[model samples]
Target: MGFPSISKFLFGPLVPVLRIEGIITPNTTNSIGNKLRKINTSRTEGLAVVLDSRGGSTGQCQTIRNQLLQFSKDNNIPLYCFAENFATHGAYYILSAGNTIYVNPTSIVGNASEPQADIDFSQFLLKNQIESRIIASNPLVNEYRFNWAIKDSEKDKKFIQEITDRISKLILGDIQVSRGKNLKVNEELLTKEYTGKQAINNGLADQFGTYEAILAEKFPLAKLDHTSLTQFSFISSYQWNSRFGKAIPLFLLLSLFSLKVFIKYTLIIQSYLLVSSQEEGQEKEKKVQH
Candidate 1:
């Protein structure tokens, strides 16, 4: 109360910064969705998303991108994206939602591709004496589970490739639309990987700088309050586990020791009470005899 809380008075309007680090799985997207609901855009000038992910679930990536787009549009606020370390493929998809994308100088940028199967492993299976015969009523469903099926069936390969192409296109489309004249969209650009500097030159990124510095420069009037910003701290299982898991064993041992001490003291008190009662009984008997 003495200084009137600097954040509320000095900063003016705060900008919400969200950090999306590590793998973006279905669970990760759900966590993001929960956090997004908590963000009150009315109190903030703009939203800053700091992305640092290699790549993850394609479907979840699309969901996160769509959600971010909706949040920005609804709030009528600028959504700035800064790649902390790197943002590639699925991560890039989310980054594309930003009005301006920034990356650190050394951060790796793009690598929008899918996994490919190596040569057949039937011989290896035979060598290992492994027998696995997957059966499904539907051909597509069966082929979906069979890794080696792609080698034999052109249709299966095409089917897998088509989905990969679609996911890549989604990333490209967002980047192209967001960056507009800055980005040069092409087949090579979509397939090839780029360094942070290369990404900036190619228009994949608007600038190369830290998220904090960019926010200070871009939104001069806005204050960056990390406490008010949306945090994924609540969603991490490891943090909770590490916090409480370490203490559980120690707590159990202490509890056992305490219980043992309690039992020992109780027995000692019981023994003393029994001896006292016997002495009282002996004294009463002597008086009766007298």
Candidate 2:
């Protein structure tokens, strides 16, 4: 009741504004996509899609990207991100799809890199139809198509790197073109690897200001339902405390499992040594008797 309800439309039928402040995934894509489809079909007066997510799946990001591009292009909607605490690689990649990117000076942006290798499907036995399609069309499978569940082959790793490299180049080019000035930008700011001054100096973001200032300039009554607040909006949902080790990446989890296995083996080795020592003592007593 404090802030404006997202359920309540603030603007005209033309402007179907959606906030993307949390994790963006395929599931989220379906929800947002459905809303956009309805809004577009309904013929909204103007559409202003605001993306605020830190980013999620590559496939989902692309899905949102394509939809936004088409919708914005058709309805003259401008997609702009108000870069917050962190907007990393995939986050920045999705923004490039926007016609224009607006950021506060302190807004963190940049740090583009090849998307992390997810899954490998080298031994993947695609059905005849799918295999033939791949062979015939050979879509850019290497770019960002890994399932992360599949083990990657050496060749697959190399291909993935190549595609990520290309995507990185494309993003950097976008930043350069947007800046409209000739300055070398590391182009990795989106990877959560940039400061406000660094972002401005590099030209990844325009200026820095509080949400109040930035939004007021654009959206007069720009009220934000912070993800933290919106999270409680459901009231019926459960909440959990943030744990230090819980945020570790999946690869790290695998590493920890391997380490535990190693420790287990060390204990087994100790047991083997104790048994061997006892056997040797018994054998020595028999030799003395001889």
lDDT of each: 0.74, 0.56
- Give the 10-residue window scoring lowest on summed lDDT in candidate 1: 230-239
103: Cα error in model 2, Å: 3.9
Overall local distance difference test of candidate 1: 0.74
Error of 1 at 39 (Å): 1.4
The numbered model that scores best in TM-score is 1
Per-candidate TM-score against the hidden true structure: 0.67, 0.50
Could you tell me the TM-score of candidate 1?
Answer: 0.67
Count of steric clashes across candidates, in order = 0, 23
- Candidate 2, residue 237: the lDDT equals 14
Candidate 2, residue 198: the lDDT equals 78
